[model samples]
Target: MSYEIKKQRILELIAEMVEIDVNEVKEDSDFADLGIDSLMALELAVYLERDYNIFIKEHELMNLRKVEDLLSFLKTN
Candidate 1:
């Protein structure tokens, strides 16, 4: 998939995981700052796993501070 498309999908999944309107998710929005708790992060991991087939370890999630982190990870790995 194109990087932009992948990024968009990532944002969409994140929005869903957080139960927020997709329009509310900004590219630079920090995951924790989005009001996502630990349980929500795990939920996001599961959703992203199903959506992109990316096996995101818990530690890796910590490295993900913003939506760009996710896009970069998907693009490089």
Candidate 2:
């Protein structure tokens, strides 16, 4: 998938998880700022891994603190 499409999907998933509007999720927005706790982050990682057919280690998931971080990871991996 294209970067923009992947980004939008990720934002939508985050917004759905946090009960917020997708438009509120900026590329630079921190996951914590979006009200994502550790469990939520893990759940998002699972979704990303399943949807994108990629595996992400726990430590790597922990490091994805911002939307951009996840996007970059998705792009490269």
Candidate 1 lDDT score relative to the true structure: 0.80
Which residue pairs in candidate 1 have backbone atoms (N, alpha carbon, C) closer than 3 angstroms, thus clashing? none
lDDT of 1 by residue, 1-77 (tens): 67788778778877877789999999888888888777877877887688678888989988788877877778876
lDDT of 2 at 44: 87
* Each model's lDDT: 0.80, 0.89
Give candidate 1's root-mean-square deviation (CA, Å).
Answer: 1.8
TM-score of each: 0.76, 0.93
Q: Which stretches of candidate 1 lie over 4 Å from their true place?
A: none
lDDT tens digits by residue: candidate 2, 1-77: 78788888888999999999999999999999999999998898889778988688999989999999988898888
